[model samples]
Target chain A: AQSVAQPEDQVNVAEGNPLTVKCTYSVSGNPYLFWYVQYPNRGLQFLLKYITGDNLVKGSYGFEAEFNKSQTSFHLKKPSALVSDSALYFCAVTHGSSNTGKLIFGQGTTLQVKP
Target chain B: GAGVSQTPSNKVTEKGKYVELRCDPISGHTALYWYRQSLGQGPEFLIYFQGTGAADDSGLPNDRFFAVRPEGSVSTLKIQRTERGDSAVYLCASSFGPGWEQYFGPGTRLTVT
Candidate 1:
């Protein structure tokens, strides 16, 4: 019962364009993805993780994410966008048999970068 | 070098009174976490400490909630009676052990009026 589905609550890009923040997961066996970022008041900030081979995961300021094992999805990318890169965006999951890192979050996505 | 740290960043309780929240990990980080955020939603774990015990508290939500880390690097989260849905924003994380990669703290905005 590891779930995470951030079906967009807000997303509007423009600055340099190219931005997408969406994720999905259900986990049962292989899944250990994560991407976090929060700004207004600050807290979370660890923008990358996919554990195992790299399904195109690159993180930090420039951001990047793509691990679509048959579309179990894990999208969070940015090719340009900047307006300080907006904020709030989280998508987590833990499985792969569990080592008890325990994380299963979602329901957060508000990346408004317009300038 | 001094990452996770949470204290009375902001707290205004009153519902039924009785609150205490504090966390200070990341000195060696043996794993310690507690989450609960709700104002847009995201963080929500509740408990997990691995140096002083409490392997997991099953996302505490009842029994007046409680937590402690004794001498494993500071950790305390005790709430009793307090309601108003227990006002959100109370997070603390640390890791370097069990699964790894977790370091957050800048939370503790419980406001139950």
Candidate 2:
């Protein structure tokens, strides 16, 4: 089974400071990891994904994630936080070999950037 | 190109009523997915469709939940005997193929009283 875990329920960061939202996963095979953000009353927006490549993957809105295979973690990061960037973040994983495109998501983490 | 879209942005009904949510996948997208999200929780996978067939329906909670995609482009999720617990935002997403990044729809908020 493929599953993801977001350890934090909420994270608060000051504006212009770096922000990090933690995520870890467990899968039977190589994992395809993804990060998505959701704002009020809107659908989730894709941030980035780690299929197979460098350890670090950059995404939209100055966000990025580091895929640490050894740790089974893919934490989302932003160099500088913005008040508008506050939203709910979700981490998801799927088995690399699965053709169903079935994604198992983590309990979301709410990111709040305080100005 | 338009993104994945779902109809009935909001629906309110009494328990035991039948509800149907529709989804229109992006043009040429071969993969479609349905998920349910409750307040303060991440989205939970409900089913996946590949072309006109359901590739996986194991995520569905029970027999009361059913979906169909006869034409491989438009899909409909049917929930029979809707319960209060079924109140949630049902999201639809589509991708070019399996293992690709999925584009999500605005979701239909279903409120079962």
Candidate 3:
């Protein structure tokens, strides 16, 4: 079974400061990891993903994630946080076996970027 | 050109009532998915469809929830005897195919009173 965990319920960061939203996963096969953001009353928007290749992957809106194989982690990072970046973040994982393509999501972490 | 869209931005119904949520995926997207998001929680996978047939329905909470994706472009999620626990934002997404990046709809907020 593929599963994801976001240990922190919330992360507070200041505007213009670096922000990191941590995520870890457990999967039997090759993991297809993803990061998504949800604004108030809106459906989640994709941020980035790690399928294969380089450890550092860049995504939309200046967001990026590093896939650490040994740690089994894919942590999202932004060089400078913005107030508009305040929202809920989710980490998801799916196994690369059969292409049913179902994503198992983490509990979610609320990011608050203070201005 | 248009993104995935869901109808009835908000729906409030009494418990035990039946409700239907609609979704319209992008013009060429062949894969569609339905998920439920409760307050302060990440979206939970509910069902997924490839073309006109449901590829997977294992994530559905129970038999009371049924979905159809006839014609392969639009999908509908029907909930029977809705309960308060069912209240949440129902999100719809579509992708080019299996294992592809999914584009999400605005979502429909369901409130079971």
The candidate that wins on TM-score is 2
Give one digit per residue, the lDDT tens place, for model 1 in A1-115.
Answer: 7899999898999999899999999988888898999999989988888878969989888899999899899999989999998989999888866766878899899999989
DockQ, all models = 0.23, 0.85, 0.74
Runs of candidate 1 with Cα error greater than 4 angstroms are: A1-14, A19-30, A34-64, A67-75, A79-87, A99-112, B1-13, B17-35, B38-42, B47-57, B66-80, B83-86, B89-110
Candidate 2 Cα errors over 4 Å, as ranges:
none
Model 1 in CAPRI terms: which quality? acceptable
What TM-score would chain A of each candidate receive against the reference chain A?
0.35, 0.98, 0.98
TM-scores for every predicted model: 0.34, 0.98, 0.97
Q: Which candidate would rank higher by DockQ, 1 or 3? A: 3
lDDT of 3 by residue, B1-113 (tens): 88899999999999999999999999999989999988877888999999999989998999999999889988999999999999999999998876677889999999999
Off by over 4 Å in 3: none
**Higher-ranked by DockQ: 2 or 3:** 2
For residues B1-113, write the lDDT of model 2, one tens digit per residue. Answer: 88888999999999999999999999999999999998888899999999999999998999999999999999999999999999999999999887899889999999999
Task: Give the better candidate number (2 or 3) by TM-score.
Answer: 2
Give the Cα error of residue A105 in candidate 2, in Å: 0.7
- Cα lDDT tens digits, model 2, A30-96, are 8999999999988999999999989999999999999999999999999999999999999999899
